[model samples]
Every structure is written in C-alpha cells, then in structure tokens.
Target: MTENGVPILQLSGVSKSFGAVQALTKVDFEACAGEVMALVGDNGAGKSTLIKGIAGIYRFDEGEVLFDGQPVHIHSPRDAAQLGIEIVYQDLALADNLDVVANMFLGREVLQRPFRLDEAAMEESALKTLDSLSVTTVRSVRQAVAELSGGQRQAIAVAKAVMWNSRLVILDEPTAALGVAQTRQVLDLVRRLADKGLAVVIISHNLHDIFEVADRITVLRLGQRVNLYKTAETNQQEVVHAITAGKLEHVPGMASL
Candidate 1:
C-alpha cells in the first residue's frame, strides 16, 4: 500500500521474460476501490503481458501481488477468480447462440440439485446483477447474445464479472470498434462499476475516453511503468508525453501521477 491506503489490487517489482525477450520489466501498479484506473501506452508496451500476469495467464519472474493488503499467489485463471479478480477482454468471450442468462452462468451455473440446473434461480440472479449495473438496453434477458447490440453485449460481459463478486475488473480495449453512442454506453457502465465500489482497470488507446471516465491514469512505456497520474491533476498532453517519452511532468499522488 502507498501512503494513502491499501488498494484493492497492487503489483510491485513485477517482471516477465520470454526466453531472451523481455515482455515486461519491473513494474509497479495498483487500483483502488471506487475509481477507474486507465492503463495507456503505445503498441507492444507490455499492457497485455501485465494484465495476463494479474489474470494468471503468465507468472511474473519477480514481484509481489497484493489483494486488499494481503500478499497472494495467483497461478491460474481459477486462482484469480477465487481471489475475486476478473478480466474482460475485447472479444467478450460470449456464446452467440446463448441468451444473456445462459451466457452469464455459462460455466458456473447454479444447480437446483445433483442433476438439475437451477434455471429460475440463475435467471433471477442474472436479472439482479444486470439491474445493479443499471443495464436496461436489452429488452429481455432471454434474448440471444447475437440479438443484442454491441454495447449490450459488452454490458452482459461486465455483468458476468460482477455477478461473481469480483473485487477487481480489468477491461481491455472495451470501447474499441464501438460507435459513439455505444461507446458512451460502455463508458457509463465502466463508471457505474467504480461507483459500486469495485476497483476498475481499463486498458484503452482513446485518450478522450480515458480523460472522460478514468480517475487515474497509469502510463506504461515499453515494458516499464512510466508514471501514474490523477485525472484531475493531469492533462492529455502530459499523458501523451509519458506514453511516448516514458517520463512524467510531475507525480500527482501516492495513488496516481
């Protein structure tokens, strides 16, 4: 934890290498509850590698990962899930043929008994989760994922993460390929997630959206963390400089730049 307090998630001196290729250098990162932390960088900046490490897809060569001020080891996706960490990639990983409820409970369905699926309970839970996110665009939870719009599909993916009581949700390029209106929808959903007291980390290239929703910005250059900036204290120019030059005009706070 920094001087401020313990964050929901924290990474210190984390590194990952592939053979002779260094995918990431010693990196320090953190995300606190009730805030949107934007991870921004140029292509090949190790953003994917870093989140993969947090998701348990890749183990860091060296570092400490803390969850709620407690050190923990995340060795696989299941491990991350059990620790209340969920990542929503750009593809969403939804089954087109399945309805919202079915997709939400895809692998982790509630069972009525030893041999029965609890359809009613699952549906009720799904509806409640969606309602908590204020997702009302979809006419019905029974609608196929293929029938839902882009923003609605993204919302469903997020609802799935929150439904499982995930403490931290990392979104990778969530607004990519979305139209203006759809982008607005997803951005609002991101804000709601933080408002609901979840630590949210978003990886995106759009500075406009970053400035709009992010409470803090963490800029990564190459494989190293350049700087962290509080959204209220920094501007796009400073962030762009950090992304390209790997330097910060000024460090904002313990929690940000």
Candidate 2:
C-alpha cells in the first residue's frame, strides 16, 4: 500500500451473484501503477467471477470500482475500454488472417481520408509500439499472426494493450502454453509493462511464473478473497498455505486473498 492513500485502480466491498450463487463475497483489492498483482487460487476460487466483474464482462451485484480515486460503473467492455482498462485473455484473439499490424489496430483502424484505410500510418504506429517495448526481430509488420510463435503472440497481445494507452491491463494465463524460453519472454514483457507505469493484474496458476514477475500476490479461496501479500514479505509456502487453508497462522499482515 502507498502512503498516497489510493491505488491507481481499486475495488472496495465488491460482490457479485448469479441468482442464489454468490460468486464473489465482499472483495477488496487494488492495483497500482508500476506493479503486478497476481490473482491466484485453486479450482472454483471465484477468480473468474472477480475478473469478469473487473473487466465489465459481468456487472457486480454490489460495491464500488474506483479508477484513479473516483467511483465509476463499467456497464460493458466498451465502458472499460473507454476508461483505459484492457483485458488480454490467454487466447490472445489475434486475427490469424492478418499481420501483426492489422491485428493490433483491428476495429479502431486509422483512415487516411473520409473512407480510405491508412495502411502506412497504422503500420508505423504498430512498429513504434512494439519497438518501444523492445520487441525487435518481428521480421515485418506484414508477417501473418498465424506465422508467429507462442511467445510472439503473447508479445503482440501485450503490445496491443500498450498501444491503447491502457492504464490497467489484465492478463489471464499469459504464460500457460509457452516453453521455458517463451515463458521468460512473456515475463519480461510483463515487467516492461509495469516499468512503463501501467498497473497490471495477472491471473495465473503457475507458482513459479507468479513469483517470477508479480510484486504482490492476491489469493482467492472458494468465492471469497482470503489474503493479499507483498511478494518480498512472503514465501511460496506461506502463499500455498493461504490458498489451501484460507489462513496463515504465522504471517503478519497476511489478509485472505
């Protein structure tokens, strides 16, 4: 927590339900600029519900979403995007038929005139954004998305978020399918996102991947948040205990995820 008294993005007393099923229970969590908050839990941990609420894929039945210290209601994905919230799913959703440039600027295409597509400007900006993240050796902006490796796909997804000027980028299982080298590549990209001052929320199951890149860890048990811990102040065992037992008997300042 910062002495500044507010996180870049905050959810306070947030709750959600599907009829009688309470998917989330009075959850409070926050993400700050220049940091990665890992949301981890076992099966049926309410991680998905919480993420859906945050991403505006599902509206919360209760509580508040504070972006930059102001209360706001995100009614839809469009609303989230307008607020600079970008969610990068594990699938990436890139257009395989298009190249990196085309995929990055999909839907929000630039036009040279009233109706003509601005191919030149789009390619230039895509290259610029990828380059800013130190993503060189892309071969060409025209290379098809289907032709890229797993790591390159992840990089493109992240680069797309960065291109949107997203203040908070939520990543779901970014390194799940990658080999060790590819995993390292995605992790490095995540670090770069934080270093560029974007608040990142990562949903992942791999402990080593979580520990390698996350500055803070948020754990969910059942459908409730059990604990949130600073990575520097806790060990993997403590985190594991919190995930399974829903409590840490010895750790100071350990709140349930």
Best by lDDT: 1
Q: Residues 1-257, candidate 1, lDDT per residue (tens digit)?
A: 12343399999988787776666777899999888999999998889999999999999988899999899999999999999999998999999999999999999999989989999999999999999899989999999999998889999999999899999999999999789999999999999998888999999999999999999899988788989999889999999999999763323122221
- For model 2, give the 10-residue run with minimal summed lDDT: 248-257
Screening candidate 2 with a backbone cut-off below 3 angstroms (N, C-alpha, C), the clashing residue pairs are 219-257, 225-257, 226-256, 226-257, 227-255, 227-256, 227-257
Clash counts for all predictions: 4, 7
Those runs of model 1 whose alpha carbons end farther than 4 Å from true positions after fitting are 1-6, 248-257
Provide the RMSD of all predictions against the true structure, rounded to 1 decimal: 4.9, 4.2
| Candidate 2: tens digits of C-alpha lDDT, residues 17-79 | 676666677788999988899999987778988888888899988789999999999989999
Clash total of candidate 1: 4
